[model samples]
Target: MKVSFLVSLFMLSSVQATLWGQDLITLDSLRLQLAKAPLAEKSSLYEQLAWEYRKSQPDSTIFYSDQSINLITREGLDRNIAKALNFKGVGFHYKGDNVKAFELFTSARDEALEHSDSLQYAHSVNNLGRIHLNQGDFFKAYGHYYKALAAFKKVGDIEGVAYAYKSLSELYQSQNNLSKALEMSQKTLKIRSKVGDIDGQISILVELATIYELMENYNRAFDYYLQAKMKAESIDDAIGIARINLGISQLYSVQGMNEEALSYADRALNTAATSGNENLTNQVRLQLAKALLSNGELTKAKNYLSKVVAKTAITRELPIEMDAYYYLSEISKQLGDLRDSYENFIMYTRLKEALVNAEAARRIERYEGRLEIEKKERENELLRANEAKNQALIERQRFQNIALIAVIVVIGVLLVSAWYIGSKRKQVNLKLQVKNRQIAAQAEEINSQNEQINVQNQSLQKRNRQLADLNNEKDTLMSIVAHDLKSPFNRVSAIAELFNITNLTEEQRTYVGLLRQICENGVGLIQDLLDVNAFEDQSRKLHKVKINLMDLFTNEVRAFYTEAQAKGLDVQIDVSELLYIHTDSSYLKRILDNLLSNAIKFSTAGKKVVLSAVEEEESILIRIKDEGPGFSDLDKTQLFKKFTTLSAQPTGGESSNGLGLAIVKKLIDIMGGEIILMSEQGKGSEFILRFPITNVAPVSAGSQ
Candidate 1:
């Protein structure tokens, strides 16, 4: 379950230094040289001594840096004094005295600028960028980083340039700009690799891996981590090894490999402890806590998280501290300590928001976006310039070719002037002959195509007439069948009425009633068929006339009143506004009659059926609504189709052959009106008919 990672901690330790000092040398050797060396060289030796102890013994580092500064200042070595001051700042910065560190860094920057020491000035501003980053001042950090980078590049300080790039990478990473962070890290890596800065190379490798991890390029991230580990191992950098282990552990955890994550996490903690870097140890511990959390070992996870939380309280690593608080909250929740969970969660959110202020992140993104747009614009300009250059080249090449051809043609033309004239005449005559033949062939083809088209047209016309005749015959046959069917239904109705008046038993009277209902349904279905056949004929003509809509509503209601009264139903008319419609009166009446019959036929006792009409600028509207079991969704889709059996049946045990709505819709189509059914199950049904004013009203009937 465990995998070893020797990821380079060289870069990480440099970041923690914030204010880097002179190159590393053994403290004893430097102190020994200090005793033997003269005053002039002793300052340099003291500075070297300070650099060695800056990590482990910050107080001693500060003392040695002071000695160097004192000796150098008296000797008028202002540049060296500035360097020493920056070294002193690094000591204080390591000792967690940022305010004092800031003061010393500012002093060092001024001294370096006075001496025109570009390298030292760059270093000072670079350290300032780190301080701003730690303080969550992204604006100041980005500005300082830019200034440092410019200074370093101007002075051709390659190592200084690397440091600036590293600082920028960290800033971009914090802002979640993974691509930019990786780009900067790669630049640092390339520079350090060229200069044989193993520590710097290792650090950049780890940084590259982290950027890839954030981008979810796990395979690449893993590859980079492995490379960093190998490089750290070759250098035997224990801190680098510890960091690399921690990175791999996190990578595994991200992939949900809890067992392997926990294994690497434990190894990382042990390695970090051995490396004697408390920050590294604490970071590894935090990672271990997360692994345990993922594995559902809440109690153990909480124990590890508590340590990180307490350490961060003093160290003030907000990102780590925030994470620790979140895990603690989750553990508390799992343990059923809801109050503790809520408190922990609140702290976690406060720390998180404070560390990564939303407004700051947005500003960072906006600045980056603007930078990207400007970069693209510059690229486009370059591309346009290149295109112009290419066009010039092409134009020169084209003119050369044209001039060369003209010269050759002039020389050749003189030799055969007479032959050229004769050949030109031959070409013109040949072209004319070919063109004439092409026109003649095209004319012939057109004639043949026209003759074929005429034959096809005649055949199509004959088939169309035959179809029309067939439709007429079909319509006549349907009408005849319906008429014949209507007579039998009428005879059945008459026999049922006769039986009803006979001295029959109660069962016999019930049978007679059933017979009469059956006859009525049959007769109604036959009439519906006749109407549907007539309405479906596309050639059927409508006799347009102006009619009062109110009068039409009144007549339709009167015709359905008897059936409505038999069921104790009220037929009401809405004569809110009398309107005229210029449409076929017979077609409109038939449409109204079928809709009214359906309304009363399905309605229960003691219900109402309303007939209403209203006029608008463009249309006349009519509605027949009944209080009955309404149509279901499935029914409405096919309600106007032939023979659609719907969910809602007649409430009065009335028969429905499902042709009423179809007939109404067809008749409305013939009159150039539209009908819509509005109904819901368990509510009621309403049929709305709309006739366009252009068709419904040829002329306005003055309002009465």
Candidate 2:
């Protein structure tokens, strides 16, 4: 029975290896083709390379993605740009930068939506759902996944639908809803089978197997795992094979087949390492550790577990880390290292508790976010109701006024006719005089009504003027408040800077850092407030002058160099030595400063920020590009709105008062420059400022 069981497990594991087919082109083949390909073909090749390398070589994926992006930009291939961005985001996702991945997916989705490309849109949305699912935002994940399903269905995209179903299954499985996960996986399998997608079918089978495993249906799970492994092997998918081996190893370990588990674990580890996938290798190592520990190989198990633990710390895979710690504890206890065993146990317990607490906190945070969204929706509903009510009141008053005027005109016309008739009939009868007297009396009453109407109109005009004055007063008060607040904020910032320069104990330095951060945030908010007031002030005007573009860019770069360097960013400026433009020096400087600051603030360490300028015949074009988290579709709509923050947070923990871009836009407009934004969320963003050269003669050097 034991021999038969081990054989069945090995067969099942072998079948799992064929889930994903090998890439059509090898790395060398792709590189050779890329070298001689046409511009468009080269771009396509780069994108293909990015997709192929995303799983096993993330850095290479990013490099190829950048190559594709550069080519797409040169060719103005808007559609291909979205694909490159999506692939780049996939690279980030695999590299464990979920936030960056989410941003890139968002950007791709936006680009797809903009182009009305339903298939790409669905793909990006599905990816977004996966990100949210991994982040433990179940509601958000569900929302995006359903949206993706709808989009895919609308486009008649069978593949996209299957992908969405698979994602939904994984999400449900993560939530421990095995029944729903099984249902989703089965649906996905049905679709994939109908479409003759063997690879997709294999993936769904593995998912179903996992769900069954979680439910403790060992027989069913084993059966599905065998089917998946066979499908994977049929397609020659090395990664899929390794995944299956790992799964089988875990299953056998669970069944107390230590020797068989060890065999499969070693196979999986070797395959994963060969495939150059650190994530898979770590997973396989954990399984191997468990198998070895069960087989009484304490030292080998400890080594494997320790390596997994170290990698887990970097990957932030909490569950894997916890498992590694637990196993290490067991290994230590068996080796008579009681002290080490207790320490490992404590570490395991702490990590487990932290994971549980984090999950609970995330759930609470999500609930609160939902409540806030609901409250905003309610507020909007009320505002709409109030607007309707006000409109109705205005319409009613307008009709009433018109009716009053019509009645007055009729009364006047009748009185005039009566007077005329009475005058003509005066020669025919004595009663004519009495009628004239009544007409005269009516004319006097009409005159009195006219005076009253004029008085009411004057009163309305005065009230309108009063309302205008009140509005002005409100703006003035806000301006005063902002101006008054700015001084103290500046003082606090200056004081903090001075204090930061002095040495202190570690705890005191931390407190000083906090104080500095608070002061800086306050200063940023006040500056934004002041900018808002200035932007609304009609009296404020641009102070245009002949300025050197290179000088301005260099100064801004210098100002931001410390911050960027601290975060390990490379800020490069590529501009002509004497590039000059006629613009408002202060306003233009502000624009550059804000953009550079934002670029540095949002970018992760080891990324590059480039500032380049080109002199056109009629305008100076300046571009600032940063490899930071990009903006979402929703973010773009409100990008220049006062106090509007986007989904992405600054990597450096800088304060985003949401005023920087708004002010930059306003300043650009003041200088009569056109500002364009090009960004894909995960990749980075580029801000292009085109300032038209004025017809006025350049100021003399002496004027400076």
Relative to the true structure, how large is the alpha-carbon lDDT of every model? Answer: 0.81, 0.81
Q: How many backbone clashes does candidate 2 have?
A: 12
lDDT of 2 at 12: 38
For model 1, the local distance difference test gives 0.81
**Candidate 2 error regions (>4 Å):** 1-25, 56-63, 66-70, 73-81, 88-107, 193-199, 235-239, 256-263, 266-325, 331-340, 343-704
Candidate 2 local lDDT, 248-292, one digit each (tens): 888888889999899988988878888766667888998888888
Instruction: Write the residue-wise lDDT of candidate 1 on 1-704 in tens digits.
Output: 00001111223554445322233446667767888998879888887777788876889889999999888878887767888998999898777566567678878887898888889899998887776665456787899999999999999999999989988988887777779988999999999999999877887898798889979998899999989889989977766777788889999999999998898788778777775566777888889988988899988999999999898899887778998999899899999999999999999999978865744564464345445434544775798799999999999999999999999998888769878888999999999999999999999999999999999999999999999999889989989988999898899889989888889999999988898888888888888788788667677687887788778888887877777888899999886544677788897888888888878878889888888887776787788898889988888788888898888777778888888778877777667778888898989999888877777554444556
TM-score of each: 0.42, 0.43
Supply the TM-score for candidate 2. 0.43
